[model samples]
Target: MVIKGGILLAIRYNSHRYTRDIDFSTNQMLGDINKDEIANRLNKSMAIMGESL
Candidate 1:
């Protein structure tokens, strides 16, 4: 996955831009993506951070 848009620019250059969203991309096709697995992983991560979706 690649991070794009304002979030990337802010992190890469330490810019002062304010961004409210994160953008991601993958080389895999949409049909090949596993939605449940992704959701599970994200849930686990959020749990580790004491948060939830």
Candidate 2:
């Protein structure tokens, strides 16, 4: 996921005020993912939050 906006900038440098949510984006095409692969990748992503792949 590609983080952007105020949340991303705040994470980079601590902010006195910030939003309560995180915003992210991906270059993935959901239509191309198969069911089995989708389950596998979802679990993998959940296991590795905040870590670069």
Candidate 2: lDDT over CA atoms?
0.69
lDDT of 1 by residue, 32-53 (tens): 9998998798688668757522
TM-score of 2: 0.43
Candidate of highest lDDT: 1
Superpose all Cα atoms of candidate 1 onto the true structure and report the RMSD in Å to 1 decimal.
4.3
Summed over model 1, clashes come to 0
Q: Model 2: which residue pairs collide?
A: none
Predict model 1's lDDT versus the native: 0.79
Maximum-TM-score candidate: 1
